[model samples]
Target chain A: MNTLGISVDAWAAWAPGIDSPNDWNAWLAGDSCLDEGVKPNVSFVPPMYRRRLSLLGKMAVLTAQQCVDQYPIDSSLRLVFASRYGENARTVGILNNIVDDGSVSPAAFSLSVHNAIAGIFSIIHNATEPSVSVSAGQETFSAAWIEAEQILWSQMENADRVLLVYYDEPLTGDLTRFTDDIQIPFSISLMLSKSQSNGESICLQNKRALDSSDSSLNESKLNQPLSFLRLLLSPEQMISTTTSNWVWVKNSANA
Target chain B: MSDLIQEIKELIIEVLDLEDISPDEIVATEPLFVEGLGLDSIDALELGLALKNKYNVSIDAESEETKKHFSSVESLAAFVTSSR
Candidate 1:
């Protein structure tokens, strides 16, 4: 496919010990690292609904809130929430409960679904527009971006913006044996629009022409979201991230 | 009976994740669901599970009596006592 053009109207990210832009810049410079066992404070959410959100959900919602705060969208906003392994900790607890006594906490079960965070966000914002939840293995972020891009491309008249959120946490228990991706609990939210006139223009191209065996290409230790965040925060012209099947090249339009 | 009421109040605070509310602040006679604590139906279900796990009490989710038992800390304490 040709390089699909898009613009980032606003962005926000959160992880333990890394919240502000300065923190992210320091992290990219290898001067700081994400602290373990620290959770994002989402006190803005009312107590009643906040109780239902898992740590991952809190990260997603918090970043999205911060992004919107930076650039408020007055037009209809569509949301695309992406997570590779969403709420696995909560789901594991529910499964253990079922095995132990054939009973589960109703609230835990309710919030364990993949789309539960998206549901919570829609309810909290009273956003009646269409929303989608996605999980696509290693290519989850790229998939979500493509989904957001498609939404903007197809529904430009009805909706001018889409909030793309990606969040995940380290796998626990036996589930840790599944993959070797970075285990940090982090979230990135980007407000994307089709209008190229405003904000930072970027393009995503599927790297089919590039040789898959190129020795110069290095795999990033950080996961896709963090890698993309590094690219966004840095002055780099382009960064290539490889998933299981596809290599995605993100380029700054200015470069 | 008051000890059981306090225990249930703490349990409610713990199970429902009422982080800001202290046990002493929860009036035993006040409604636990909407109009008082403002908890919705999901809280009721979660509280029922906690009660079942802690007190081994069977809650008929659809029964009017279950609603009565879940109305307040006092009512839940009475239900647990009777069940035991």
Candidate 2:
């Protein structure tokens, strides 16, 4: 209820091999395809810093860095990183170690937490500005967008831009049994501004889905961030995605 | 000793996810943790597991002498060779 309101000025996404806007456009159009063998090449991250990141963490950092590189991000920029399931493999690996050996690896314990990637980014950029980490079950990405809106409200004094990032990868080992079919890892970064830069001003309204049955229908569901990215690339100025309780609408002209 | 050292180097790189680092970059006798390679305790445990898996070697991971075994690629090779 306490939001000054904001719109995204720049955005970027990174999946295994989805590199460019044209690539994304092709993907959205279903005119192109991705090579499953291709994993995110986070070779841009220096070796000293790279070793600590988990597989998913590396992809998240890669996409976040790519977004910052393309946009105007500085020390003052606020960061909101969201993930539904973060470092699941690492966490599971730690648990397995504990179960089998009665101990967990030091790095696994240190890096298994939800905000580990965000912490890595902060250290890399030396950005001490306010940062928040969010986890909102099936609606993690949408929750991040809402938090970005709230960031604008809090930073009304300087009116600084908030870079909201959402990232997740599928769980491995026995934990896979509990999760839905999340085939690949993905990350999206949106640079939000209070002043509405020349980039598109998309409107977001939280509501209930028109059809609730289909919400839980996808066994191997399209990742919500991917759906949102598709909406951004689609010609339709308006589209909506449904979570269990909330439906997120992306409108280019509204608000 | 050289073969064991090379094997240990490969194990360290792969297990720790040291992507940009190649086996040739590691010095034979240099300290492995907090200095030459900048590895820490967790890496030690990971490397221990990898070594155990690859060589079926038993490691006294908590012992004071175990720290010496993990101190360098050369020491790790010695530990593995002696265990064998």
Q: Best lDDT goes to which candidate?
A: 1
Q: Report, for every candidate in turn, its global Cα lDDT versus the true structure.
A: 0.82, 0.73
The superposed Cα distance between candidate 2 and the true structure at residue A205, in angstroms, equals 2.2
Q: Which residue pairs in candidate 1 collide?
A: none
TM-score of each model's chain B: 0.96, 0.94
Tens digits of per-residue lDDT for model 1, A47-121: 888988888999999999998887664547888999999999988888888898898888888898889999998
The list of candidate 1 runs beyond 4 A from truth reads A73-75, A197-199, A209-221, A244-255
TM-score top scorer: 1
Candidate 1 lDDT (Cα, whole model)?
Answer: 0.82
Per-model DockQ:
0.81, 0.49
User: In candidate 2, which residue ranges exceed 4 Å CA deviation?
Assistant: A1-4, A29-32, A97-103, A155-159, A179-182, A197-200, A208-223, A244-255, B1-7, B48-71, B75-84
When only the first chain is scored, the TM-scores of the models are: 0.88, 0.83
TM-score of chain A of 1: 0.88
